[model samples]
Target: MSAAEFDWNLATVWETIAEELPDAPAQIQGERTFTWADFERRANGVARTLLDGRASRDDRVTQYLRNSPEYLEVSHAAFKIGIPAINSNYRYRDEELRYLWEDADVTAVVFHGSFTATVGALRDRVPRVRQWIHVDDGTQPCPEWAIPYEQAAAASAERVRAPWGRGGDDLFLLYTGGTTGMPKGVMWRAADMLRQVNDVSTVHYALEDGAEGIRRDLRGPGQAHISGSPYMHGTGYFGATMAMHGGGCVVSLTAPGFDAAELLDSIDRYRVASLAISGEVFAKRIVDALAAEPGRWDSSTIRNVLTSGGMLGEQSKRALLEHWPAAAILDGFSSSEGFGMGWSLATKDSIPETGRFAPGPNVWVLDEHEQPVEPGSGVIGKLVVRNRLPMGYYKDPDKTARTFREINGVRTSVPGDHGIIHPDGTIQLMGRDSLCITSGGEKIFTEEVEGVILDHEAVTDVLVVGVPDPQWGQSVAAVVSVEPGAAPTAAELIGHVKARLAGYKAPKHVVFVESVPRSPNGKADYPAARALAEAQRQPVA
Candidate 1:
């Protein structure tokens, strides 16, 4: 496919790559590596099987696997047949899992062995889900009700054609972050998303030469990247896809969850070029691991540390730099709904301000009235994208209408983030507007307070929220997890925030827990933390 004739669907680019670099390594997990040709063959088999099983275009298939190569295999297969693959959070319980499956109206499930119990329990609940494909990771027994993944994947190796031609119109459902509420599926057209997420057909590579340009760029020594976030989430999955598209290797975790040492080992073993982490939790854990034993892993191969899905606080960036000074730390500000908007780059010589970004050229800041916020005004407005955006939230027409609305005659994605577009064209991200705490008519972004508190030496992890106060209406409450060998008092932590930010922004109450509640992917669980914060505190004025 030439750059001029490139199809924007996910399958087309993948096919172009597979045909060009048939023997190049595509997916890497520990000692195992599958070449582009091998991965495509497996995907072909899955596609043929699914098509034979009466799976139609745009049918939703839920993937409940852990971080593994099966994720890409199934996702690729689904995309080939024009099916929208729905990523299920592996950390979800029975109810949560049922809710997503029911919401997506999942026709089939591809789950890991570890989740057999949950899948089995949900089998009767979601009776419409007739197809169950189980992956045997040696963790648990393959349920009798399900077909072994290998058996299904080996059904056919032929390229299954989608009767309905694949295009940018193919749906890709990415469930948005549900820190405070149930997650919403952000539906994206493959073509639109390809252009939005990655400038593939455009100026990135020499599209004029097509496959030749691809071969020239991607034929060399592989640039390996390991996504340290959940495959079920946008950050990791998209990173994996992007890496694969570049003809680099996508490395998955050996263990089910975050193991700092294990991650370092993979980086050392594979000579990984980049590492994608979600936020501070991942950075802190890695920093702690490296700080504990600096010589444990040789991290020289890593050139870029990519952070997205959540904020990578300034202090954590510094800590990460202290360990891997050679890497360029990039903190991308994006959401499931929005495409590329802004990013912060930190090198050894320069550490970017936390939450500040080099805004994309298409970025915009719109006030509540839908008017553009004037540059240099230092006014906080809703961060929005004037560029091409996602289709909308799946099934939720109300939310779809609200999030993807016309701003200045261009359809936009306002993912509820607040920011100020500075005079220099840079964007200063405040935080999510949905989580903004209003106290006595003062709007305080929880991220600002949390960032300051996290800078303290005694703090490990923290989430700031608003607890009801009689006088202030809602006072800041810091739910923190202190570092070992240090017991920072509530007043001391409060002082930490006050020293950095305004006194009014400091948490009036502190709830020190064993650990902050988080999704398996280490993303914050604001609802759980808010509940904990609200439980113990008495009425305050």
Candidate 2:
């Protein structure tokens, strides 16, 4: 098909790649490597199984697995079958998982065996889930109710063509970090997503030329890009998609936890051209490893190192360059709803500040009156993006309307990021709004943690805030007041919150004050509370 005839569906592009470069590596994980041919055939088989199980067009498929080939394979299968694949955080406890799946109205689930026990406990609760496909990790057996992923992959090899067919209008649901009450699913249309990817991507896809554009880029064995972030997050998933669009190999680390050595080994083993990470969290760890044992890993192949979801400080970027000067460190400032908002690039010659970024072409800062903030005006405004945006939150019109609004007659996505536009047109991002705390790239809502902390009998009032940290960009700190006779250790309060929410959302530091600082009107005095916590905060060590 010609580029003009191409509708920009992800499945079409991937199918074309399979035909053009069947032997090229599509994905790699240690001993396992999936060629483009293998990727297509397996995705076809999974799609066929979903069809046989009565999965319908635009049905939601939740990926409950970690960083692995199955994650993308399932997404590929969903695209072919006109289904919207949903990402389920692997860190989510039972309640969070329940809330996410229910909110997304997930119809099918592809999970790893490690989560079999957890799924087994909640299976009866979510009856809408008709198909349960389990990927084996050798830790637990696939339950009787769940279909083995391998079995599904071996079911059929024919290309999946749903009765309703597929198009650019197909949806891809990405759930945001639950900052308010619960996480909301950001619905992205395949066409908009494709255009957005093309807008920022080095390789351009000619909509007029159709599949030939993909064939044109099929120049040698594709580049190998390593993603260290969890696939459930935007940084990892989008990075994988961007790599695949270039017919590049997406390499994943198999280490259950973040292991700097494993990442370095993977880079050397795969000759990785790009390494995508989540800000200074991973960069610091990588630097520390290189510092501890210099000249240990041969990292000459990496030409680009990208960070998103958090800031990569100048110090961390410079440290990384010391080890691999050939690599250019790229830091992106974006959110689940807004991609290509702002970015900063660092090389041996130049390294920008941590939170400073070059504004994306369509990005603008708007003041309270919705007027564009003048450059160098010293005014903080809501960062907004104009084109190639999402279709809004799934099933939540109110939030969708609020987040995706018309600004000065143009549709814009205002995801609540505040920033200042410098005189040079660069952006100095302040952060996400006041209530949200970004720790190691995870957005934790103070209200969410505070509500959980308040559930404890000993705690009468609580206010959660973010404190600066060397490793995590910020750590969750809780300032609390207890009942007059009650005395609770910080661990007890932390454990109480951890039991209800994800461990990352739990307070890393706790400050026990006589009373939580509140204003005359009973509103929280966040500034004073932050000061108190900063002074008395004790790490949970």
Candidate 3:
């Protein structure tokens, strides 16, 4: 089918899946399992509930639940009713939650009972929220103002018809970190989101022929999958959606926090075929767990290990290879924005520096002038996108126009990234352009230094930043996690980077820490890293 001819709507996608695989397992959370038919019924009930409550088309409903079957039901139900569902990052404190709730104009919030205190603290701060619903797993008490999730589901009507809207209707409002100001919401149309499913089905999964071929070859009955990232992020959303698209079972582990052992246990119990993990931290944790109990879990069912959002540094990559050599480790670069860009299918010979893949259609690496850079130039440029780009940031047109621009008649979206386009058209991603620093008249990218440090045997994970220096405008600083019981000095890390990279790019100082903070999507928390560096530079009284 032609791209234009394809119907890019969530309802259409869900209908197709329901027709093709009515009895297939759509979602699995702990011991709970939902077939495709069951999912549709639950989603319909949710839509009826929201509609009866006077929810209008395109109204925003924020979800603050952990990984569970309820989150998926609410998401699908919101889509069926033509209301956009915003996934709130669980890490947000009261202040951050209040800001997002106020900014998104969230009319309703669905949160787990455990977060009652946090939500209660911000009740007066968020004036837009009209309804408060709590998902109680039987332990926590339902608050006075909140409705129980099960009761709401049972009371709401079922099999409601779709709300009137076209494919371009708003589907979601995902908030991304801002370069200069507060986090900005990127609005996604239903058609644009359907394009994401198309990209996954057509480009990534190579499922152009349709569901028959996927069912015959790629997936079987009760195919198990797991996403080790928070549902609020893009990767988790993509992974869950793709699993449903293929008629596979999505296994969600509702751990109090990230625990590699618990994740592996779920995989072993479910015989999960696919696993999506964000960064090297989770990967390394899995590797360590496997090492500690080599015979405890049966990981033979795992076939694909999808990693993204941040670097799986050379160390973690090597560890994964050693543990799960047969699994295909696929890495891709994408954003909350509609740009689904590059991919790298890990092979036996793939390395951190070599075998990086090229971006797909609608993506390009451009120079400072926003023109496509010449191949083999080795000059770093901003990464740009050309297809189905966001119209503008929510409520901020001027800044949106600045980032999403038209260069030489073709529109492009540059999400503040530094990269190099190789002669073969492959792009090597450097850190964000906003994080680049100039020290002693020399410009250096933090990612380059972090990559070098990560290659060291003793380092588990690392982050690079710029700190205040007396002479140099800014000095390179490194924060790293070392192997348990191993300590390396700042001079050693500097020497390691100096040997592989230019002398000026070497870190001037290094600090060892238990772990580096990361965004919900596994991107390096550079802001936190820079704050740590700044705090360290304080003058002694």
List of clashing residue pairs for candidate 3: none
Residue-pair clashes per prediction, in order, are 1, 8, 0
Of the candidates shown, which would achieve the greatest lDDT relative to the real structure? 2
Tens-digit per-residue lDDT, 329-396, candidate 2: 88887877888888899999898865678998889899999999999997878899987788898898
- TM-scores for all candidates: the values are 0.93, 0.82, 0.92
lDDT of 3 by residue, 134-228 (tens): 89965678899887777666654456655564344555677775433566788777667766775674123323333443444444344678889
Model 1 TM-score (2 dp): 0.93
> Which prediction has the highest TM-score against the true structure?
1
List ranges where model 1 is wrong by over 4 Å: 1-8, 200-203, 206-221, 537-541
Which candidate, 1 or 2, would have the higher TM-score against the true structure?
1
lDDT tens digits, residues 125-215, model 1? 9976878999889888787888888887887767767787676578888876566678788887776666553462112445445445666
Quote the lDDT for 363 in model 3. Answer: 82
Ranking by lDDT: 2, 1, 3
Off by over 4 Å in 2: 1-6, 178-180, 434-535, 538-541
**What TM-score should be assigned to candidate 2?**
0.82
Candidate 3 Cα misplacement greater than 4 A, ranges: 5-8, 162-168, 178-181, 202-222, 352-355, 519-521, 537-541
Full-model lDDT for every candidate: 0.79, 0.81, 0.74
